[model samples]
Structure formats: structure tokens, C-alpha cells
Target chain A: MSTTKYFAPSVEYAAKILIYLSRYKSKQSTLTEISKNLDINKSACLRVLKTLEANNFVYYNSETKKYSLGTYISVLGKRVGENLDYLRIINQFLEEVCELTGLTAALVQRVSFDRVMFISQYQTQIQPRLSISVGNRFPLTEVSYGKWILANVSEEERNYHLREGLKKVTSYTRTNLQKYIDELSEIKRSNILVSRQEYTNNVTAISSALYDWKGQILGMIALVGVSSLIDEAEEQRLCTVLKEVTNRCNEHLIQLKIEAYEFPYESKITQ
Target chain B: MSTTKYFAPSVEYAAKILIYLSRYKSKQSTLTEISKNLDINKSACLRVLKTLEANNFVYYNSETKKYSLGTYISVLGKRVGENLDYLRIINQFLEEVCELTGLTAALVQRVSFDRVMFISQYQTQIQPRLSISVGNRFPLTEVSYGKWILANVSEEERNYHLREGLKKVTSYTRTNLQKYIDELSEIKRSNILVSRQEYTNNVTAISSALYDWKGQILGMIALVGVSSLIDEAEEQRLCTVLKEVTNRCNEHLIQLKIEAYEFPYESKITQ
Candidate 1:
């Protein structure tokens, strides 16, 4: 099998096992299930799981003979420390957004090329309210949280990012390449990104980018709720609250910036 | 070179590199610096860093020739999922404890054999307060949080855990093995663990094991502050608050159990 240079297949496979178990449908996946789904040999899969288990990167249940992501990931992630205070501040803002708009709000940070993870979330008392899981991921090219990040990058960067076809998440999602790029540019101009049944069919979300005092993109502040409760005019009002909170957050978060980006996500792509 | 069964040296080294960069005294580490510190060959170090960067497990700053932990760790950890609500509950209790005691409070979770990771922390308006980073680790066999968890385990399990020599973290720390085991047994009776300038000088911490409704130890809830502010009476009062908050938390967190515990941390040791 051909692999990229500098990529160790064993190590990559180990990491994949971890990422896979975190998203596994069940709380744990058996060796046979993992090997089959992840396309690895059974022995190699066991070996990888064993190594992960040894390091507490994954836990194995002897009775079920299944594997799950370990607490070590959370421990290591927390040690990525500089942004702790920033996340706390974002969480407080999320609470206010949820409170003011009678909806749920979340702070979404880009996790990878294809995913943005929720760092913090707040739920309102509004009946039939919806809330996203804190550590769950959304597609970068699909969800408004992900698209806000995608839209802010330069054209060259955006092209390199979406070199692969944009996978449609829902029927309402824009699929045409030119149209998608055009929409991203439009969102950038408006400085408010919205998704109505684009990511999940019943949810409506409006998001805006957070910037530090130095003009660096920190993450995205999103106001999310049940689609039935939010409308065009209401979304516009929530955007106002989001902007105010983000502006206040920018003042406090200026010093807590995680300056290391994805090396411009392919420093080569940028060049 | 001989390596333990199921342990991939390269994957282990890559994880080590990520952990190292996180705790590195400096903001970033150069290839030579990491190689020299971690005792890996320069070529191997370069290869690991490159692979980690490609996977966004590490970030490479070409201009500075430095490496730092990547955002993937945080993202993946968040996706671990089951503990998110529990962590949020813990954070709330911490805030309440901190508010009541006029001290800093933290929730600590066992992350490994020898360490517990901070899950949440809050500081009050009291002057000269102390706090720890949420993701930072403390030795399980040394500090109050670790000792609390250690105390609950069977003596056989405890002995198996620290088969290796326990390193002294501070001058006042108990270093004698027999004395350590005896002290652990004694502390279990009192149900409160205190570190009087043991882990770090001038910081006093008193902790109690936070348990779920099932009576399994979830983690430790600690009330910490400058030693000057915490007298014998204050410590007692704070413990009351800590227990009350943890009890309230247990009610909310009963449904959020992280059931995937390490499969008998000493399976090999038992053999």
C-alpha cells in the first residue's frame, strides 16, 4: 500500500483507531468490528488496540472484547493549556446567547481539515430546545461553524482545502463547487454565516468568527436552536448579541491566543 | 533494542513528543532540543515530528524550527463524549466550592497509573489564591488527589501500582515506602486528604474523593489556597462545602459515568 512520506503506517493506524473509537456508534467496538470497518488486518488491529490500551490511549473490555477511547486523550488535550481561560470565557458567552435568544449556543473550534469540535455549549430552557455534544464534530465544508472558518481563508487556501469534492450533508446543502465557493465569499462579506437544515435537517444555526485584538481568528461563536423557533428576523437579532459577546471576548482573549495554526494548512499549498 | 510486547516504539515516541512539547519549559522545542531531551536519534525525531505535523498532531514552525502540540489532541479528547456533561457538572461544583471557601477548587480525575489530571478549577476573590491548569497532571502516589484515589484501592492493588519507587516531589513529602503505605491506610479512616506544603511549597490542599451514585470513585474534589489562608478550622469548613457540592454533582453526573475504565491497571503485574 502506498503511504505519504514521513507517515508511519503503524502510528497512523493507531491514531485512526483512537479517532474511530471516539466516533464509534456504540460505546465500544469489538476487534472484528473495528478491523472490518477500519480496513485493517485483525492481528494488526489487535496489536494497535493493545498498544493503545497499554498507554491508556484506549480501554478494552475483557468481557465484551471491545475497545473505546481512553481518558488519556482528554488529559493530553487539556495540557494543550493556553486556551483554557478562553474556552471558559466562550462558555460564559454561550450561556448568555442561549439565555438571551431562548436557544442553544456553542463555541466551535476547528479540529481538523474536515471537522470542527464544540469546546463549550449552553442550553436554554425553551421547550424543544436542541443542544450539540461538546466533543462532537461537524464537517468544515458543510456546517456554518466549519464554513465560517473555511470562508475566512484566502482563495488559494480554500481551493487547496476543498480539492476533494464537497460531500453534501443534507438535501439543502449547496453542492456545486462554484456556487459553494461563491456562497463562502458571500458569507465572508456579511460576516454572519447561517445554516438552515444544511447540516442537520431540523436545526438552524447562525455563526460569526471571533477575532483577537491582533486580528487573529480565534474560533466561531454560534447561536443554534430548533428551526421552528428561529426565523430570518430572529437570526438577525441573535447575530447582534453574538457580535457584542465576541467583541467583549476579544478583549479578554487577546493574550490567550493559540498562535500555532496548521502551518497555514499546507504551507506548501499557500506557497 | 528490546521493547515491551504490544508497544510500538515509534508510536510511543510520537506520543512522547506530543507530551514533551506540551510540558516543554519553552513554548516550543527544536528537533535537536527534543532529540537531546528525549534521547531519540535526530533523524527519528525529525521523522516523528514530520508525521505528527502531517496529521496535525504537532505543528511545525519552519521559521523557528520549533514544534508544539497540535489541536487534534483537544478535538479528539472532546469527542470522547460520555464525560462531557460530567465535566461540566464538576466545573460547576468547583465554582461553588471556590465561591464558598474563598479559595481555589479543582476536580481531579485519574488519567494514568501514577497521575491524575485536573478536570476543572475555580478561584475565588481571595487574595494570594492558588490554582492549577485543568489538563496538568499530578502524581497519584504523591499529592492529595492521587493519594485519595490510591487510598480507596486494595493494598494489593496499591502495592502493584507503585512497584516502582515513588519519587519525592517536595522536601516535606513522605518518602519511606512502609511509612507511605501506613499513612494511606490511616488517611482512609479520616476520609479527608491534606497536603500541607507536600506537592508544592506554600500551597495547602484538602481533598475528598468524589463518588458517583454507584459508589465508584469518579475523581477528587479539592479545595486549595495559599497555606496562610487555610487554618485547621477553615480546612474543616471547606471540606464540608466540597462534600456538599460533590454530592450535588453526583446527582447530576450519575448518568454520565465514563464506564470504560482501564482493565485492571495491573493485569501484567498480577501475573
Candidate 2:
């Protein structure tokens, strides 16, 4: 929690290795493959992998002479999932949105200044539904949630994020700086974003920002589906619902305030 | 992973810190508190924490000057949950057990030689259900699953586990090694474990080992409830059902074999 950033190289390598394993979890990798692919020194990566294996962060398959993510990652994940109240609350709200709209609902968390990742998602029991999974990361300048994020940050920060040229993700992607800025201003006013195949083809997304007590954007809740499935009337209804759900979520979070910071790790038995 | 254990101290400290954060997730701990409690050197801990923060493994509260497990932990956790096929299959089977038996059903994973943790659980809607949560660890020599684990291991390995000797949990606890070995033999024949208030008072548990294609005991599936609620007839019925469910699970797992090693990380849409 230091103000000045100081990274431990070994720690960074370990995190990278764990993430690499998670990314290609279906493939168990040898020490040589992992060390080479991640560009870490062979002996150093081996030491970290060995340490991870001992801690159960990565599982070692002795017979195959390879490694995969171990039990501890899931253990830590379950603990975190149970502990975070805001996450739980947002998830409940997202479920409601998913059920009502019969679309895919996802809770995305801003991981860094320019990056956000889907932490949890609820998909409809409908054929040809969106196949987005948790852990998928997107840039702050792309996607509906990204606009909500850009709409809330300070002007300087916003410009810095956009300093990188806009990506034309699809034919429908908005690349004009002025129009994008205007939309962000609109998002700031209405607290909702509506994108018609802006990031991905045939996908329409509506998103609303979740705010802490200080009005800082924590993250965003989004509803995504194929654009063809969402008519003009449907998009309006979706936007309205997202705004209300996010508003209620933000209000509840504000009232919970700092106490919400204390995430209870226990899963209560529901009678 | 190497044959000779060469732990990267910094990596070890990072894992320990993250686990500690998960253990006391409800509390945001200052650097001094974390460093002192985990016995990690202050500067070394700070560097690791900073690195973790950069990777979103730990969240740093600038205002409070404290730390908590960050967004990336949940991201990794979700990916692991999705990627592990055995976990998904077992969870599905546990859900069936909970519904059919109206008891708390849990999928326990062997984390180490002498330790196992509840990776997932399904509880019935009935009142007074067992309140065990995921991430709760138990010694491999305790609980119904522990008994199953003991029964599956080699006699020498089992003896080593019991070397510390069993602490009599209750009057019902079987402290006699002779009787315990006889029961383990019975378990080997039956492939089912029935413990009546042995580990915790007034708790009855039925467990069956899950096996890999190699026929090694991977972990266990356990049904738990209050002793009084499980009448004689109910216990017999429960035992029969658990045996059937676990048998099907084991058969399916054996068929899965090495391909099961590759966990699909995608959340497929259920139509």
C-alpha cells in the first residue's frame, strides 16, 4: 500500500506465470515451455514454479512433467467471492437484469487505469447467446463499460487513456474524437452507455457505472447481446433498466459505505 | 517444478501474503500488521505487495493505507473454476446429492499430503443445514472424507499421517487404532464411509472417494447433516444414494482421463 511503486521481480514473474497457466489451463506446460514462453530466466522461473507448486498455487503433474493452476487458486477465489459485499450485491443486481431481459449480464471490474476485466457473468438459457466468460479483459477506450469508465475519470486522465489512437473495432466503431467526447459527456449526464456493435460485430451493449460513496467509479454493470435481437424499443427498455439497477446498486453501496469494505468470507446457509 | 525444492523466497512471501489477505479478507491490514504477522521482512513485504497491487493481486486502499486481495484474484479464481472439468462434474453431482438427500453435500479436494479443503458445497433449502463453507481446510486424518483418504492410502503412508495420533474429538471418536483399521477395511469393501458424530458432536456424515483413471483416490464426495435428522432407514438410503452417485462420478472421471486434465475455461451457454 505504499505511495511509491516498487515491484519485486520474483513476485511479478510468479504472477505472470500463474496467469499464463490460467490462460492456457487446458494445456499443462513443462518448466522449459513456461520459462521460455514467459521470457523469464530458466532457473529463476523454475524456482518460482517450484515455490508455487509447494504452495498449491500451481499443480505439478509428475507423470507428465508439466504444471497447471493448483487448488489454492480456486480456494483463494472462493474466499474472495464470498468476502466482497459490493461484488455480491452487484452480482445479485446483474442476475435480476439477466433474468428480466433474457440477455447476458456481466460485472466488470476496473483492474488498472486503462484496463478492466469481467469478474462475474450471468448468461441467459437461450441458444446462440453471448459466450463471454469471466477474466476477459478489455481496454478502457473500448466497449460500453469502457465509455462509462472514461466518462467518470478526470479530464487529464481521460485524455491520457485516449492518447493511444482509437481502435476501429468494427465498421460501427466510433473513431471520431469529437463524437466520442460528446458521447462521454452524454454518459456523464445520463449515467448510461448504449453501443451498437461498437466493439464487437453484431453485439449491442448497454452499461451503467457503479460509484462509491465519493462518486468515484468503481466499475460498471453491462448487458450484452446480438444487435439484431435488440430492437429500438428493446434498447430503450434495456437502457432504462440498467440505469435503475446501477443507481440502486450505487445507493446501496454508498449507504453501506466503508463497512462494505469488510467482505465476509463465510457463505451463510439460506433457510 | 524441480525434483529438488528451491523456493524463491520472494514468491513464497507473496503467496503467503495473498493467502493471509484471503484468510482475513474482511479486515484491511496495514503493511506493518501484515509484515509482522506473517513474519515477512517489512521492505521485502512492501515490494511484494506493491508488485501484487500492480498486477491487481492485492488492492491497496490509499486512504486507509491498508491492503486486501485484489480483483485479479477473483479473475484467476473464476478462470480456474471454469478450466477445471473435475471440479465442474463433481459440483454437478454434489448438487444432485444435496437435492436428493436434503443434506449439505461438499466436494473436498486433497491439497497436500496431510491437508484437504472444501473446494465447493451445495446446501439444501431445509433449515438448520450444515454451515460449512468453501476454503475450510481439515487435516487429512479428520472428518468423514479424511477417513476415506486414510482408507485409500498405503498402510505406511496412513500410519505416518496418524503418527501425530488422533485427538479424541468426542466420546464417539474412535481412538482405538485396531478398530479404526478394521473400519477402514470395511470402507475398502463398501467404498462408502459412514461416521456417526465422530468428528463433530451431533453431526452424521457419509462420504465416498472419487478416483482418477489410475484408480488413485483423488478426493471425496460427502453428505453431512445432523445425526438426529438422519434416522436408521434414512442413513441406509443415504448410503445407497451416495454410493450410486459417487460410482457414476468415478466412472465418468475415468473415461475423461487425460483430456479431463484440460479444463475448458469457457462458460458455455446452456440452452
Candidate 3:
């Protein structure tokens, strides 16, 4: 009896092709193009593409003879959200925040220095909700999430990150070595970061850092809306709610045995 | 002149790793496991994972010596939602349907028999709101989307499909040779299919097919909610709304030069 391990090998190849397709989602590619890009043989690429097409992971445009992500790729994303428990944990709180503040609630995690990835959002039930998307990236220094992350960074690490991270994002982006050091100190004192239309005109965001059980800064959850919707009073009210939610989430994390990070600058006066 | 395409290729590889990690998100996998799963060389997989770790697409657990998807992945998904224009188009109408009918509204594209990916959803406000995830799959014959899709097959093709597709899902699944022929005929006559507690007890769904500008069935959009919420009068109202919204969506498709399939079924006089 001869036993062949064919499924694993083919599944592996299929996985690679899927990875490649995800990178070139906006730009369609042909078999030859994929072959050349991945440096794999043409036949192997063709085989992988065929399998993906069958599974609805990739689609071939018969007219152009090019390939793009199939509609099913979005389905894969939906599975990711479900498996990660994001929908269960965050949905209601996000809706409440959006309802109370009339601002979009965005959850962002740091991906790279100038890029933070958006995970989920609850949009305000009004015209011109802050437009953003899942799997999109934003500069860490140009948005509330970026500032919130920076506020949690150590003093020594702040300068290095600012120089390397904020270089490409904004012309008005702060680059002064000493200024960043001082700003981090101030943020540490405040335990909150406010960006007044930093990312876009008339869009303001207030963000606080979220922690895992191990005390690592996991990400930032921000409440963003038009500046007109968030005056000083409204901002303060949002801050209170945001703080409470963060605290509750922290407790949830602890219950799950994830470590929680403490705010560096804790002040009873602000509360 | 030595031009380094280092960043582009690495970025591409890194993106692939991100997508790969997306599949095995909750369970940490070692470098060897990932290489074997992706069918890349062990050394190459390590390099890709390193770059992903550096970019925060993955996090390495030192103690376990395995890697899990970092918080950054969720962040990226959120950003993708914010930036994707097509989602916004569907979301506007999805919200209205949810509000009018007080049921969960879903925009889904068929992935496979095992999966139907959710793009966007307006979940019911009630506790224990139908637990549907963005990316999940169900047997085609047991769900609203499946019935609607099944109704789209041509006469001869429909028979072949039932023989192959219907036998696998459920024992109570409509695999009766004559009954299936008649069911498809009825669906063709009515243009809408209803699954009354077929997938889950006390849950009902009514779905209509959607087409692209090219007249291909893109997928089906279904209104799903508890059976109690969709009484006969409410069901009629919700179906009217679904028809209107689907028509509006079809108009958008036509503007893009897409043609919709004409429904063969006429309104029944009994109702």
C-alpha cells in the first residue's frame, strides 16, 4: 500500500498563493506576473491559482486573463473577526460610545512606526462620520491613537521613535528631539492624548491606551468625530466614559489572564 | 547603480505572512509549523515571520516559542473597513433595513458551501442577538443565502446541483428528487426563498439574489432575525423593504454596466 501526503503539500502551496494575492489585492496580476513575483515556476503558480479560484479565494477575469482577490477573501476576514472574539467583546461598547459622543470609535493597534492598523469601528449616526476602514494604516504621529501610544512610551524611547516614525507622515509633525522628550513627560502626567484636527481638518480625536494582562501596551481605542461635536464639556464627558471603559476592559483582560499596563502618570486631580 | 528592490519584495513577503497569520490567528504556531503549513522553506519562513514581528503583524511568545497574530491585524481590518468605499455603499442601506425591521441585516457574498463571508452587519439590539460573525460558513441548503442561490440555477443545472449539493448538508435537507424540482420551480416563480427555522430553531431568513453588471449572480443579501420578530405582517413589510433596497442596489449595478437576472416567478395570489 502506498500512502501519499498530497493534501498538505497542495494546501501549503495554496496558502502561499493566498498570501501573495492579499498583498496585490488592489492590483490584478496574471499567472506569469505571479510566477515572476514569487520566483516560482509558472506551472506551480497556475496550479495554485486554479485551486484558489475553485475555493473562491481568487478569481480570474476571463477577459483580461488577470487575477484578483475573490469575494471570499472578505469572508476570510469575517472569520478572523469572529475567531478573535472582537465582535463579542467590543461591539456594544463601541456602539454606546458612538451614540453618546456622536463620534466614530476606532480601534487601532500599532503595525509600524508610521502605520497603525484599524481593526473595527462604530460610526456616529450622523452625516460625515469619520471615514476609515478595517485593514487600513495611518501614521502613528498624525492621529489620536498615535499620540496615545506615544504618551505611553518611555522618555528615552520617545526621541528615537519620533525621529524614525514621524519622518514621513506630516510636515507639521514634531521632530525636535528635546520637544518630544518634554511632550512624552507631559503626556505621562496627563494619561490622555488629544489630537485637535491633527489627522484631518475639523476632525478631533481623544484616545487612551489599552493594555494586555502582562502590562504591555496593546493598542489605543479612540473616539473621533467632527470638532463641532466635541466641545470642552463634551470632551471631558467622553474622557470619563472612555476611562471607565478602558478600566473595565482592563479588568476583563485580567480575568482572561492577560497582563495589564498601568498609566505612567496617574493623577487624581484630573478625574 | 545598484537599485535595491529590497523594500518592495520584503513588503510583499511581509504582507503574505500577515495573510497567512490571519488564518491561524488564535493558535500560536512555531516557525517550522508555519513553514510547513505555508510550504515555504523553513529558513524563508523565519525571515518572513521576523519581518512580520518587526512590523507587529505577529507577536512571538518567547516562553512558548510560537507566534500568534498581534493586535495589529485587527487594527488593519478596521482600517480596511474605513477605507473601502464599497462597504460604505452597502452599509447605508443595511442600517436602514435593520432599523425598519428590527432584525439582523447582513451583506454576504458566497465563498463556498462551507462558508459565507459577511462584509457588514447591523446586529439586533436585543440580548443574544443572532450570533453571526463576519466570516462564517453554513451548509448552502440550510440557510437563506443557499436557497436563494439554489433558485438561480437553470432547469437542467438545478437538477444536477440538487443531486450533488443537497444530499450532503442535512438529512431533512431538500434532496427529494421530485420535490426539489418542484421547489426550484416554485422559487423561480416567486423570486424569493424563505428558510423558516431551517438553519436554527426560532430563526427565519428571506433572501433575494443579487447580480453584477455582467448579469452574473454576485451573491444573495438576506434579512435574518428571530422568528418571533418576523410575524406574517412584519415579514411582508420586511420583504417589501428588502425588494426596494435590492432594487436600489441593482440600479447602482446597472450604472456600473451590470445587468440583473430577471426573476421568473410572479407574485402569488394566495398571500
Candidate 4:
């Protein structure tokens, strides 16, 4: 909450270790393996892990002589996931979108500046539905969801990722940095972004940003399917429905803002 | 993990603040209120909260000048929620229980020394089912889920909470420590626990522990509904289905152990 950043080394290291555990692996790891892989000294790692364990941030198994994150971490994560008013709003709206359009409808959240987390998703009744589990995190710059978020962040932050150079995932990947920036600006201006075979060979995605009552970008709500499902006529329909989803979310969020006094931690997705 | 406990005061205090926030209030609290209420020094509270905020463990709303837990907490909670293999295994098994008995089914985990957490739940197709959400936490000495976990923990740890004296929530609430201890022992020896309106009126719960391959109690799976639904005739059917559910989870956990070699973290629930 401080205007000036206050750094705490032990706290920072503990967080880094948790992020590493969450990102790199889900199973138990030995002190040796964690210390070596994360490059923290064994003794200090022992202290922090001990602290984390005592606080229910990590769990230690004596028989296996290894460590894994504790269940309390999910208690925290549930709080985070619960704070997204859009998730509540998207429930009926996403289902309706899927019902009307016969495609997958999803809500993604920007976890890190350059990574988006799939928080909620629904699949249509069509055969051979595209399925991805909730809580899946991916690089924002590599997928259509990435462009949807990249379009909202500050131009400097977007340029930082641009300067890192977008990798060619498919032949259609945009390699021109300037053109990519231009494309992002246009997406931002238009409030929609489209991708065809940018991450995988056959999948195509169309995404539009979901906004809170104050107009801050929360993330993207999108409808996706195979490339064949996204033909010229379908794209227009998809855009219209996707736009409707966002508008509905915004409306629900405004209602939630009115309902804010009834609870704490409401409408926290303004950013 | 070391056998001897090494106390970290700072870490301990930080956890206490978080717990207080979770238990006492879900809304934003100020430094003065938290400091005076928790009896922590304002300066020290500021430092710890700032550290927590830095790690995305807490969020500060500059507009209202208040603090609530950050979204990252739920991100961690989701990870922990994802780790509960029984939740994954009990999906089909729970539906079977609900289908056979027309009652709600659920899974609960031991979250703290004196508390149990509801991690997964399923509703029956029948109208007016008893509903308790996932992530709901209650005192370990009061609920059927508590007795299931109390039956497993060390005698000393169990006695500490027992000494706290269970409050009378309903007419069936067990307030006598001796009776509570006897109840827990019977449940532990029998490997199951049942509650008839011990916590809430007109509700009944029957629970049995789910163990990993190592025979450690990972959590509990049960069917619960209106007290009338838990009639003796129905109790037998509930036990049969619940046991099947536990067996299915154990089999899945063993399969996971075999698959552990393919990933870095595995068989973590043994802790």
C-alpha cells in the first residue's frame, strides 16, 4: 500500500519459491532438488520452507523427505478467484453465449503482466468441443487472449514485450514488431482481437476485453473453436455475441457496485 | 523437514493477521483497527502488511484507503484445491451416492489443528437439497467432519482443541469434553463419524476417512442431507456408497503414485 516500494528479502524469496513450485512443478520436491534448482542455499531454504510449512503455505512429508505446497495456498487462491466479479457475471452470460453461438465461451484474467489465466470457461453442446481446464496459465503474447490483454496495458509495457521479439509459433505469427504494435493499438481502439492458428495449427480465437464499471480492463471474454468454425460470416456473429458478453459483464459489475455495501472485497477487478 | 520445531515469530504473526482477516472479517480493515483489535503494534503491523502486499498476498484500495486480501491468495487456494485428488476422484463416485440416496455428497479436509475445510461438494437431483459450499471451514470439535479428522491426529493435538470446550450449536451438540473424547475415539476406531443436527438443525452427516496409498488420512468423503434422509435404512446405503467412494479415491491415488515418476511433485498428500 506504500507509494514507495518496500522490499523484504525473506518474504520475496518465500513468494519466489512458491511461484517456482506452482510454475515448475506440482509434486513434492526434496530440499536438495529445490535448493539446487532454485539456487537458494539449503539452510536458508530450510528456514523459509519451515516458515512456509508452519504457516500452512507448504507441507512436508517425512517419509518421502520432500516438500509440496500446502492446502492453505488454495485458501488464498480461492479468495483471489472469488474476487473477480466478472466470474460471477460471466456465469449466466457465458452459458448464454455458448448456448446461442454453439462455441466455447471463456473468461481470462491477466495474472502477470504478460500471462493470462483462464479462470472460467464453458463449452457449447456441439460435437468435438474444444476443452481446456480452468486455472490454466499461458503467455499473453502468444495467443489471441494475449493480444486482448496486450491491447489494454500501457504502451510502454506492451512495447517491452514487443522488444523481446515475438517467437514464430506458426508461419502466420506476426514477426514485424512495428506492425505488431500497430495491430495492438488497433485492437485497443476497436476493443477486439482475432487470432488464426497463432498458437496451434487448427484452432482460431476471437477475444474482446471485459471492463469493470469504471472502464478498467479486467481481462477478456471470448468464443473459440476450430478454424473452420470461424469463417467470414461466423466471425461477425462471434464479434457481436462476444461484445454482448462484455457489455453484460459491465452491466452486472455496475449492479455489483451498487451491492458493494453489503460485502467487502466486491468489484475488485476494476484493474 | 526437521523434527524439532523452530519458531519464527514474524512469520507466525503474519499468519495470525491473515487468519484474523479471514475469520473475524472479510471486509477491508484499517491499520488502527487491526493493530488495536489484534493487539499488534501499528508500526509492526504496517511492516508485515506491506510485505504481504508486496508479495500480492494482500491488496490495498487507495480510493477507500482500506486493505483486502489480493487475488493471488485465491490463486494459491486454487492450486491447493487442485491438489486434492479425492475431489477429482469423487466426482463420479459422489454423483453415484447422490443418485442412489437422493442426498448431497461432499469431501472435507483437515485444514488446521482445530478446523476442517469443505473442499468439494455435489448436490442431489432432488429439490431442496442441503447445500454447504466448498471452502467452508468450521471448528474441528463441532462437525462430523471434525470427528473424522480428530480421530486421526495425535492425542496431544486432539486434546488441545477438546480443552477449548465445544459450544452448543444445537440441542444435539456435545459440550462435555469426556463425551466428545469418547465420541472421537469411537469414530476413530470405527473409521467413520455421524452427526445428527450437531451443528445445524434438521441436517445429518455421515463421513469416513479417505487414505492415500501410505494409509495416511488425506480427507473425508460423505453424504449429507435432511435428518429424515439419514434414517437407519438410508444409513446403510450411505455407508456402502461412501466406502466405495473412498476405495475409488485410494485406487486413483495409487495410480498417481505410479505416475509420479513422470512428474516432479507426486504423492504429496501422504504428508
lDDT of each: 0.70, 0.78, 0.59, 0.67
Cα lDDT of model 2 by residue, A1-271, tens digit? 2234566888989998888887744346899999888889999999998788767788766556777777679888876665655667788998998988888998887765566788888988986689677887778787667887777766766787788868898999879987898999998898888888988899988888777776677777888899998999999999988888888888887875622122111211110
Instruction: Give a tens-digit lDDT track for model 4, residues A167-234.
Output: 89888787777788788889888777778887777887778776655556666777778987678898
TM-score of chain A of each: 0.77, 0.85, 0.71, 0.80
Tens-digit lDDT string for candidate 3 (A1-271) = 0022111333334444544555525446778888887777776567667545544456666555776655445544544454444333555666776787777887777654445667678887588788666556666565547665666656544544466554423444455556655666676565566776655667777777677657677676778778877789988888888877766766665565443222222221132
Which 10 consecutive residues of model 3 chain B have the lowest summed lDDT?
B262-271
All candidates' TM-scores?
0.66, 0.82, 0.60, 0.80
How many pairs of residues collide in each model?
1, 1, 41, 19
Task: DockQ each candidate and list the results.
Answer: 0.26, 0.36, 0.14, 0.28
Best by lDDT: 2
Question: Which ranges of candidate 3 are over 4 A from the true structure?
Answer: A1-106, A117-136, A141-175, A185-190, A194-207, A213-215, A221-271, B1-108, B113-134, B147-175, B194-204, B223-251, B254-271
lDDT of 4 by residue, B141-225 (tens): 6677877766666676667657768888899887888888788778767666678888889988888777665666767777788
Q: Which residue pairs come into collision in candidate 1?
A: A135-B78
Fnat of candidate 1 is 0.39
Model 2 / residue A266 / CA error / Å: 39
Q: Write the per-residue lDDT of candidate 1 for residues B128-164, one digit (tens) a residue.
A: 8776776677767767677777777777778876788
How would you class the docking of model 4? acceptable
**Candidate 4: where are CA atoms >4 Å away?**
A1-5, A24-26, A75-87, A90-93, A148-156, A211-216, A251-271, B1-59, B73-78, B81-100, B149-159, B164-166, B174-177, B211-217, B240-271
Ranking of all predicted structures according to lDDT, beginning with the best and ending with the worst: 2, 1, 4, 3
Please tell me which model should have the higher lDDT, number 1 or number 2.
2
RMSD for all candidates, in order, please.
7.0, 8.2, 10.9, 6.7
Q: How do the candidates rank by TM-score, highest first?
A: 2, 4, 1, 3
